[model samples]
Each structure stands twice: as structure tokens, then as C-alpha cells.
Target: MRNFQKEALILSVRNTGENNRIVSYLTKDEGILTSVLYGGPKSKLRSLVSPFNSGTIYLYNDEAKHSSKITDFDVKKYHLSFRESLFKTWAATLAVEVVISTKCAGSPEECFVMLNGFLDGLDLLDENQGQTGLIRFLWRYIGLLGVQPDTTNCQRCHKPFYSGNFSQNTLQYKTGGVIYSHSENGFVCTDCYKASFDNPERLLFSEITSKSVVYLQATSMCEPSVSRNMKLSDDEIASLKGFLYSHIESSVGTKIKTLHSGIGIL
Candidate 1:
């Protein structure tokens, strides 16, 4: 058995075996790890080991069984702001699941920074700006996983979504550049969306507007708090969320409970 301690974020937790709980953490040293938290629902650590909370965790690993148990968790922040509404809760849950699904695929430091920034930004965001804020966070998270769809050029038609300045503002709207297909495998230009219109094999394809392109470009490479938040209409939020969440589902190869649960709410 090996015992160790590290700074970690509580990504998720679930009750198990009546009293005990299973806790998932994004550790600064170990990336993403799941360990059993002994004791029942009434345990002292139960409250501390929660979604969106960051802290230091002490764990005991059993080498033969390849399993771990949490000895102690000292939380630094509870991130209670997101609990204010259903949408905010859904957005936070989405972030947690995305991080876990990707296994924090790059430098753990970079991934940790982006995740923290996103949660913080969401907490600070005004209610009116929730949609845009959520979009920015999701885009930033997707980029960290190294699977972000490139909107600058179409993978199928070999056409450029942008022109001179390499900015979303420079995208040529003419010749049908408004929409793009994010098939299960990869990206296809909006102009070519007709080619595979009836293929049921493709898991999902996003019809993103020029505004979405702009938003993606702006948030793709930066932390979530880079700029002031924007206000988007209900339809705009739904479309953007649908587009980004589909990319996540395709990449993770799993259903997203948080995204689907919202239904008409997200």
C-alpha cells in the first residue's frame, strides 16, 4: 500500500454500498482518479467531497487491487455560486464531466488552469450572460482536449471559413459558408452538408452560424475570463450548446447526462 497527498478538485461523487461513497478527483499530481471514500452518508468527509470543490486529498493506494481509498480531503473552495440555478448547475456539471471524460488529456497544469478559470467565470457571470459564458467555457474546454473542430478551413470541401485576417470576422459568408458539419468522425464544410444529409451513421453535425465561429475563435485559445460576457438569445444559446456538446459526446463516446437533462432548460 502507498499513501500520498496532492492538490485535487472534486469532479464527482456518488453513494455506494449504502453508506460509503465513490469520489472522482482531478488531482494536480495524478490527473483524474477515482477512489472509494469509506464511511456512510453521514461521514464527515461526505460534505467536503462534492462536485466543483477543490482541495488537498490524502489517498491510500492498494497496489495489488489497483484501487484507492480517500483518507482525508481538505477543501479550499466550495464554488456554491453555480448552485443558484438549474442552468448554472447544468453548465458546471457539463464542465466536470468533460474534464473527466478527456482524462485531462494535456499538461495537467494547463488543464487545471482552464477548468478552474471556467468554473470561476461561470460563477461570476451575470444571469443574463449565462449562455454566452457557458459557450465560452465549453469551447475552451474542448480546445484543451486537442479535438476542437477547425472552422478556419473546411475539412471536406477544402474551403476557407476565413479570408485575410485569420479572424472569424473575415469569414466569407458568400458561397454558403454559414453552416458546418461536425460529423462523428470530423468536420465538413457547411457548403458540403448536402453530400451526407441522409447518412444515419454520422452521430451529429452542427450548423453553426458566423457568430458561433466568432465566439469559438475568441474563446478557443484563451482562459474563460478573457473578456466581458455577451448576451445571446434563447435560440442562439441552444444552437451553440448543441454544437459544442455534440463534439463532446463524439469525443467522449458517451452520453452526456448534464446536457441532456436540461432539455428545454439549457
Candidate 2:
């Protein structure tokens, strides 16, 4: 039996037999992992395993079986503020679902930090402001997961694009990502922009949305405190919500049920 301890954020919890539970968590050093809490419902550790709970966790690792068990944990923050309203809870749920759906590809530290920052922001937000934080989180998470819209070059041509040279920008749904043009209604790589004549999947990202995404990325890459102050227009917010959700749906090949049910709330 090997043992270790680290600070963790509880992503979710599931009851197994009687009182025992399987708790899933994400940590900066350890990626996402799950461990069984041996004690039943009455165990102190069970309640602390609630979603969005941040705490230090001790574990029993069985090297022989390549598994781990949560022996004990100390809850640092329970995030009770989210429970005050449905919108807050749903926003938190969406954030958690996004984390659960997207696998960690590179260093887990960035993703962990993003999750913590999202929760911290949630703690101080009201219904009207929560959506901005959630949208910021989704964009930052998409960037972390490495599926964010290509901003530099054409996905098809692999050539650099200058804003001054392009008159329009459009996001390609099929192959080419973002495109820019000086004369064309849709500015993409010259190759794909022309290809759109036959391919109907390409859609133009409105000027407000394209600029908003760039602004969101710029601020998110810096301090969360600064990102929290970021704002979006009604149209920009709606467009952004569609864009991020579409990206996630495309990646997972399925619609996020919560996103549909909770539409217009944010």
C-alpha cells in the first residue's frame, strides 16, 4: 500500500455500496483521478466529497492493482454560494461537465488553475454576471484543451493571415478553421474561401464576435481578476455562447444536454 496527499477539487461524487462512494477530483499535480472512500454514509469524508469542494486529500494507492482509495480528506472550501440560485448552480454544473468531458492533454496545472479561478469568480458573481465568467471559463478551457479556433493561419493553407489584408473573417465548420479576405464576403484562406462556393458548412463570424473572442483570450491569458472585469454585448454574448458550445459538441460528437435545457438563462 502506497500513500500520498495533495490539494484537490472534487469534481463529482457517486454512491457505490451502502454508504461508500467514488469521488472524482482534479489536482494541479495529478490530473483527474478517482478513489473510493471506504466508510459508509456516516463517514465524515463522504459529505466533503461534494462537487466543487476544494480540499486536501489523503489516499491509499494499491500499486499491485494500479488503483487508489481515499482514506481521509480535509475540506477547504465547500462553495456553498453556488447553491443559492439555480443559475449559479447550473453554471457551476456546466463548468464541471466541461472538465469531465475534456481530457487533459498537456500539463494539468493550467487546467487546475482555470477550474479554481472559475470557482473563485463564481463565489463573487450574481446571476447577471455569472454568464460572463462561465463564457470566459469555456474559452480558457477550450484553449487549454487545444481545440480553440485557429487565430494565426489558415487551417487549410497553413499560411499566416494579416487583419489588414483581409476584409472579412469566417470560421469553417468542416476543414479550414478561420479565414480572412480583402474582397470576399467571407475572409478565409484564399483556397478555402473559394472552396466555400461548393462547401456550405462555412459560417461567417460576426465582427463583434470575432473581436470579442480575441479580447476574451487576451484577458484570460493574463490574470483572472482582470478577466472577471471583461464584458460582452448581448449579440456578442449570444454568438460566443453558440461558438463555444458548438466547439464542445463537435469535439465530443454529442450535444451537451444541460446547455440546451439551461439556454437563455445566461
Candidate 3:
């Protein structure tokens, strides 16, 4: 058996056998890990299970050649701001859900840093700004996973997408993963779009308008502090948020409970 202590953020927790609970946490030292907390419900440790709470834990790793267990824990900081503000709570839950759903054990340090920075940003933002912060976090998360859509040049042809008075209605290849256009894969040239109109299955992505696509891609690469200054029209912001949320849901193949519960309200 091996024992160690580390600071971690509670990503999720669920009731187990009777009084026990299963906790999933992201630690600076260990990335993502799951452990069994004996007598969790009845013990004082119940407070540590809430999402967004940060704490120190004493873990016992049986080293069973496959998995490990956390027999005990101690709370450090619970971030009471989440309870005072409903949006903060929602944002925190969303952040936790995204990380929990996408992350595997032993991920890179960059993932941990991104998540930590997002949580800290949530703490600083007011309720009205939470949604934008959430969008930014999702964009960064997708980028970190290497699944972000290509908004640069044409996917079909290797041509740069210039910002002229281009047609607003362009189709994107669904399976290409990168590049945004109905006709080609990488960066479809105007000539290519004019050529291919016969094939089906190549659906159009009208959700991300040209203006919105430029902002989403640009904002994802910018510094976190400048996110609030990003000027997006209400329609553009709404479209970008919806597009990213749908993409994540489709990729994960599961509906996030927090997002589903507060759908009408958002």
C-alpha cells in the first residue's frame, strides 16, 4: 500500500454501496483519478464531494496492479462563492462535467492548467459574463483535445479564406473534421464550390456564420484576460455557444445533466 497527499478539485461524486461514495477528482500532480471513499455520506467528508470544491486528500493506493483507492480525505477550500451565485454554480458544474467526460487518467499538465484557469475565471466573473466564460472554456477544451474545427484556409483547396464580401451561406464537409466549406475538405476555393454540388451527405453548417466563426477561432487563441473585451453581437454569441455545445454533446454521446436541467433558463 502507498499513501500520499495532494490538492485536488472535485470533478464528480456518486453514491456507492450504502454509506460510501465514489469520487472523481483532478489533481495537479496526478491529473484525473477516481477513488472509493469509505463512510463518505455519514462522515464529515461529505462536504468535500461537491463539484468545484478544492481540497487536500489522504489516499491509500493498494496498487492492485490495475487501480487505486482513496480511503480518506481532508477539506481545504470549498469556494463558497458557488453557493452565493447560481450561475457560478452552473459554470462550475459545466466545467467539471466537460473535464470529467473528456479526460482520461494521466493527461498532460496543460489540461490541468486550462481547467484550473477556467475555474479561477469563473470565480472572478459576474453572473452576466458566466455564459461567455463558459463558451471560452469550451473552445479551449476542444482545442486542447485537438478536435477544434478549422476556421483558417479552405478545407477542399489550400487557399486562404479572405475577409471580403463573401457569400454568407457556405456548406461545411461533415466528415473532414477540419476546414469549413461544403465543396472541399481543407479550404475549399470558390472554384471548387462552384464545381461540386451533385453529391449528397456533404451537409452545410449554417450555424457558424462567417463573422461568428472568425470571432470563435480568434478568441480561442487569445489571452484569457481579453475574453470579456471580445465584441460579439448577441446573435453571434448565441450561435457560437449553441454550435460548441452541440458539437461537444455529439462527440461525447451523452447529455450533461447540469446543462439539460437548466436548458429553458439559459
Number of the top-ranking candidate, with lDDT as the measure: 1
Tens-digit lDDT string for candidate 2 (52-120): 889899999999998899887898887788878788888888887777776554657888888888897
Runs with alpha carbons beyond 4 Å of true place in candidate 3: 40-42, 64-77, 104-106, 156-203, 253-258
Top model number, TM-score: 1
TM-score to true structure, per model:
0.77, 0.75, 0.75
Model 3 over residues 173-193: C-alpha lDDT tens digits? 233222244232223544555
Q: Indicate the residue-level lDDT of 59 in model 1.
A: 91
**Residue 101 CA error for candidate 2 (Å)?**
2.0
lDDT of 1 by residue, 131-196 (tens): 777777777677776777775656777676555443222434334434545543445565567767
RMSD of candidates 1 onward, in order: 4.0, 6.6, 6.2
Position 144, candidate 2: lDDT: 75
Pick out the ten consecutive residues of candidate 2 with the lowest summed lDDT.
165-174
lDDT-sorted candidate list, best first: 1, 2, 3
**Clash count, candidate 1:** 1
